[model samples]
Each structure stands twice: as structure tokens, then as C-alpha cells.
Target: MRQGSNFLWFLRAAVGAAILLGAVLLTACGSVEDVDLTPACPTGVGRGIWDPGSLEGKDAGPEVRKLLESPRFGATPQAVRDLERGIVDQRLIAALRTLTQEHRICVRAFKEGHYFLPGVEDGPRIPEGYGKAGGLPNTHYYGRAADVWWVDGKPVEGNATDQDVMEIGEILAGIPSGRRPDQIIGPPRWARDLGYGNQRGWILAPDQLELHRDHIHIGYVNGEATNETR
Candidate 1:
């Protein structure tokens, strides 16, 4: 009888162990169904018409020019050059303006030597298989993506946990669904330990997380545009 009881106990213990392991695995591999994928704020505040001349502060009018020239919403020289060449999405500029003006968050868009190039340079190297969507080149190539390494005058490297950095990520993530950035990867804390797009939240895989430790990468759908100019 004792032998039978021991066998039963062993079986129960094995089952319990298996259950525990499964739970651990489930938690480690977070389920998309379980998490709230809905955008935190879907107001579409930053949506703006695509004006290639906006980068030069011309076609979009004086307000956009003022915003682009503002110290609070500055960019690196290379980024400025890219902007002058009309290489960034208009929505991104609007988002930057919103971040700076509405939230009082100073943002330096794109690290120097990095703006719209594909291969990689300073800051975080674009992870392999990233940047491309639907058999097309990466969003950066199409000017729909940017990497901001400075916020509130602080470098993103050591300030990943800073309030400004976290807020920036949160705001970017909260952009309206559909027009929202499909890729919003930043420091671990603000990104909810994952990301916020691709039907699974930004950082699709663990491998992509490390690549975004030093900068906030924001990429939108390639062809999206708005009719309203700033």
C-alpha cells in the first residue's frame, strides 16, 4: 500500500513540475492575445499631410518651418541634411513637434551619420531582417523611420530609464492605430519589456531588443500619409 502511495505522490509531483514549467514558459514567451495591443492613445494628433518640401520648411508653411527650426526639436547635421532632402516622413516631423511642444520634451532626431541610411552606423545597428516590409526596403530607406538618441538634452544610452525617454516611447506607442508607428523600440522599461507593433508589439523577438538599447527607433508604415498640413 505504501509503495502505491509513493507512486501516486511521484506522479502528482511530476505533474506539478510540468505545470510549473509550462507556466514559466508561457510567461517568458508572452502571448499577444493576453496583452492589450490597442494603442494607448488613438487620437491621431500627429497625423499630417505628406509634403516633401516640408523638410525644407517651405511647402508646409511657416509654422512647420518654425517647428523644424526650434531648438527643442533639433536634429543632427546628417539628419538635417536628410530632412532638407525630404527624406523623412511628415508624420514623424509632426510627432516630433508634438513631443517637443505639447509634452515639453526636447528631441534630437536621428543620430549623426545615421539618419536615412540602411546598412548601419552609430547608435544601434539595424538588426538583420529589420527595416524591410512587404518585400520592400526598410522604412528608413523610404524616410518613414528615424532613430532618436537624444531627449531633453540627454543621451539615450544611459538615459534609457529616464522619465523623458520613457515618456517619448510611451507617446510614440500611443500614436493612433493604423497610422501608429509599426516599430517603436526603445529601452526595456518603457517598451513594456517588449515593443508596440507588428501585431505582437514592436520588438518582435528577443534578438531585436538588444539592438534598440541605445536609441528609440520609430518606424511607420511605408506609404501612409495625411491630407492635413502643419
Candidate 2:
């Protein structure tokens, strides 16, 4: 509640405008203040714990302002925010965040009351066989699937040598495989794996994840993968 004072003030401002003569108006024009730059990622390239503005000096947009104004979507939702992208389809983002929260995953960006690691993940790279299933099984082209080395932004260094990825993967298995489809290639061998990454070989490195070697591919909001048939 006290962490973000700027939004707190706007919360009481009432939509930045007033309504009159059947016309709605805000108190002032909408503008985004410049956000702070970090050494790890100067351009705000990586994902943040919460929204971009929550960082040291990022501009809080109208969406953030509206969220602040609404007392209902406070504290709870903010506590689990991890991926904060400036996308027009906010509903989809909100849905993903909600799903994460429902699974008890503590997201950095969604959560307002907590302090989180500044950088979650650097950016997902495009894996091979995008938009089309590769020569391997369970591999397909759809914006919905991705071979992420990291989840929610943080990399899970594994599959080759980084034991961290395994630890993270174990935790990530918390979400339903059908929904997350995070790795979608090679998950853990012994443990309960996700639905998409149920293929053979390559147990834990983002590199050996078939279609993904150096960089993983993240699909768009409405992407679909052709598994089993491929």
C-alpha cells in the first residue's frame, strides 16, 4: 500500500478526469513518465518482477494508473506479477497472471507488496522450426509453444550442466502441463513432466530441447501447436 505513492495519489484522483454533460473526461492528458534504467538491462529489455514502472525509474502508464485506482485489484494480484509486457491485449496477460496465481506461483511483477529480483530473464530466442513442426516428435509450429530456458523470465540452467534448471523445473511442474507448456521439448526424465515436453531424450538443457538450442521460441497469445500428429 505504501510502496507506490504516485499510484496511491492517482487512485484517489478518480480516473484522471471528471464526467460532465454526458461526456467523460480525465483530470489531465495521458502521458507516460520515463522509467529508470538498470545496469543489467538498460533499455528495460528483460522482464521485471512487477510492471515496468515499479522499477527504479520506469513510467507508470494509464493501465498501471487504473490498476492503482482500483482498490479491488490491489496487493493480491500485484504480488504475483512477473512478466510485464506493454501489450494491447491486457486481458490475455491478466489471464496468464491469474492462472499463475491460482497455481500458487509467486510472480514478481504481479505482486505489489514484495521486492523481487530486477531481471527475470533476458529475452527468449527463436528456436528452429517455428510455425512448422520440426523433424522431431511433439515439435510443431504455433505461436503458443515455446522452449524457454527460463520461466517467468529467470533462466533454469540445466539440460547440460546447470543444475539450477532442474530445480526450477521441479518447482515449475507446479502448473498444469496443458497450460504452462513451458519447455515443450525436454523436461525432467523421472519426475512428472508437462504435456508438450513429453518427448524423448534431452533431459534439462534449454540447448538440447530439439527445436531450441541457443535461444528458445515464445509463441504469440493465440498460437497453437500440432503435437502427436507431428
Candidate 3:
């Protein structure tokens, strides 16, 4: 009986040690994935780390208010006020800044514009396929989207050309794919790879929607309208 008790004690000690070692090894192997954008706002009001399952409110935090106020967004003060009515993602704000910087030379050289220019009558409206599964694919209601008004050297609405469309498409497509399904909505391949949306693609076609031709729609592709509204 003494020998059996000693053996049991030793086995228990071995198991405890093994568990501790496994935990230490797992902690040592912890990964640090790169995030493309650091959210300017806190984890609330539609401005948290990108999550497709989550919906956010339209309330802008201090950081978001600062972004809206910046001239770099290319929106007049009034236009910014209008956009603030809908909820926008923190990632989209970061993406817009990145997009503007990426196209600065083109904008300067060819007079391209972004967001809302001074005289533009309209701003971003909800895309036609806001709730469609394979369409815009979980964007719009939460303000994770925008419409760019200029491409190359002309206005997107009535003046953009096929070449302009291709150029902007490549740029928009090149934005790094999101870590989750709801983080992005674009090419069907991209959506499929993330394990969401149908295979038909998310970019609206000219025939499918007329106004889309003038301006390219950009979004962080997070969450459905029904889920978001509720």
C-alpha cells in the first residue's frame, strides 16, 4: 500500500508539471499579428476592432470627431456634419486617410477630389444592395462605406471613364484583405476566401446600378443592415 501511494503521488506530480510546461510553451509561442490600422477611437460606437458580427452606433468619439474635422478628409465642414449622421467604422476613417495619401500625387497633378467637394450637391447614400447577401455584402447601414467623387482627372458621376474605373478598382482591391469575413466586401474571390458571401462578387456593376459609375464605393465591409439597425 505504501508503494502504491508513492506511485500515485509521482503520477499526479508528473501530470501537474506537464500541464504547467504546456502552458508556458503556449505563452512563449504567442503570436503578434500585424494590424493595418490603429483605431483612433475606443471600442464603442461603431469604432472598434473590425468584427463582422458586431454592429456599431453612429456616435463619434473624440478621435473620430478629430478625423471628421481634418481637411485631409476632403469634406467641407457641412459635408462632414452630414456624414456624421450615419455610423462609420474607425477602419474606414483610417482607410480614407491612407487612400488619400496614396493618391495625393494623382490628385494634385490631375485635380482629382475625394469624399465631398465644396460644390457637390450630394454625399454618400446607402448603396442599392445594402442588405443583399452577394451584393455590397454587409456594409452601408453602419457607415463603413464611402463614395469617392473623383478618379484620374474627372468627377466620378458623369465623367469617369472605363480606364478610370480600372485604375480605381485596382487601388480599392489592393487594400489588404480583412482578417474576418465582415471586415471586407469586394471581389467574390476575396469574400469566398474569408468564408462569406456568394461567388458573384460585391462590386456593383454599371448596369446593376447607374449612379455607381460616377463614384466608386468603398467600405470596411462589416455587418449586415438588419443586424446593424437592431
Candidate 4:
């Protein structure tokens, strides 16, 4: 009886020690849920006050034109065609240009579809039972969103575990509030790692995560800037 009790105790101790060691390893390796990578805003560039006037314009402004012509940024053929025909907000153009130039990252923009028109066939048709009911229409419809599927010659899909992709997502998330997009969606693991687990606009829900796994969606409010920062 004494020998049997000693054996049982040893077995329990071994199991407990193994479980503790596994937890330690997970923490040391910086598991997604356990890691927090809230990045610091650049010097003198903390979240700036939004200038409502910045988004008020009927046509693509000079800055928007310049950014579209910039070599730092690239776009899909469909995106180029749609962008030329559609009017994109200037603030979004500025943000994308800055993202590409500063990071030396190749940003390939893609269009979602035509903006929602009253009677156009190919124009904004939200599938029934899709997304949060009563949610706002797709930002792309307002030319306030851009989808990036490729970065620096690498496809964003199937590369969620890549450090480079995570770093880029982090940079986008870290942009000062009012300057960054209102909705930034990327890989599920990296999104959580960047402290966007419970963020209002950042992707966290399972449905959103699945839809955005292939691309990074940067969306802005039509006339106002979002108020979220690292």
C-alpha cells in the first residue's frame, strides 16, 4: 500500500510539472493571446484631431491625383479602372501613399465592386443575411476603403504566420487615430496579437476573421475619422 501511494503521487507530480512547463513555453514564445504589441506612435505624431474639411470635396483633389500616379503604390487592373471612374476620398489616398513610401512596402489595391446606386445591376447589392444587420454599407461603396491582397511581392493569403505580414498589420494598426482607417482587418492571430481582440473596428469575430483572412481591409468613415489608437 505504501509503494502504491508513492507511485500515484509521483505520477501526479509529473503531470503537473509537464503542464506548468508547457504554459511557460507558450508564454516565452509569445503566444498570440498572451502577447501585446501596442506600438508607440511616431514622435510629434500622436493621434491628431480630425479635420472634417479634409474629406469635403466633390472631385479627386490634387493630392489624390498625385498618389494615384505615385510609383510607390500599385493597384489591380480592376482597381485602377474603378478608381479612375470612381472618386476616392483624399484622406485615404494620403494614408495609402504614406504607408507604401515610409515602409517600402508594395501595396496592391483591389476594388470590391461598383458603389451602391439606386438601380444599377452591378451596384452595391448586399447579400441577404450577411454581416451585422443594420450595419453600414460597405465602405468601398463610398470609395472609403481599399483591400490589399499583396504586400512586397508576397500574397497576404496563406501568409498569416509570416513575420513580415504581421509587422505590416501592426504598422497599420499602430497608425495614430484619426489618421488610420476606421476599420482595419487582417489575419486573426496577428490581429489579436496587435491588441485588437476586442476593438470595435478591428476584426475579431469569427465571421469577419474568415472573410478577411485573404486580404487586409482598410476602411474609413465617409466624412469623419475613426477614434482608435494603440
Taken over the whole model, the C-alpha lDDT of each candidate is 0.57, 0.32, 0.41, 0.59
Q: What ranges in model 4 sit over 4 Å off?
A: 1-59, 103-125, 129-135, 197-201, 227-230
lDDT per residue, candidate 2, 70-168, as tens digits?
322222332223222232123323323433332211122221232111332212232233324323322112212223333333333333233433443
Please write out the lDDT profile of model 3 over residues 1-230, one tens digit for every residue: 99999999999999999999877866776533321142222123122222222224655555555544333334433325434543555666655655554342011110122322245422334334323333333344445555555543345455443454345444544545451112323333222333322222243432324434444555544443211110
Top TM-score hit: 4
Q: Cα lDDT for residue 82, model 2?
A: 27
Instruction: Name every residue pair that clashes in candidate 4.
Output: none
lDDT of 3 at 198: 23
Residue 209's lDDT within candidate 1 is 57
Report the number of the highest-lDDT candidate.
Answer: 4
Clashes of each: 6, 34, 2, 0
In candidate 1, stretches whose alpha carbon ends up further than 4 angstroms from where it belongs are 1-64, 102-112, 115-136, 193-201, 225-230
Candidate 3 lowest-lDDT run of ten: 104-113
- How high a TM-score does candidate 2 get? 0.30
Q: What's the residue-level lDDT of 144 in candidate 2?
A: 29
lDDT assessment of candidate 2: 0.32
Candidates ranked, most accurate by lDDT first = 4, 1, 3, 2
Model 1 TM-score is 0.57
lDDT score, residue 111, model 4? 42
**Candidate 3: segments with Cα more than 4 A from true spot:** 1-72, 76-78, 82-86, 104-139, 162-166, 179-201, 204-206, 224-230
- Residue 201, candidate 1: C-alpha displacement in angstroms: 5.6
- For residues 1-230, write the lDDT of model 1, one tens digit per residue: 99999999999999999999988977986764553322211223111223345454335444446555554555544565556655567777766676765333323344345533366442333444544322344556566677776666566777777776777766765666555566666766556643444552365545455666677777664467522221
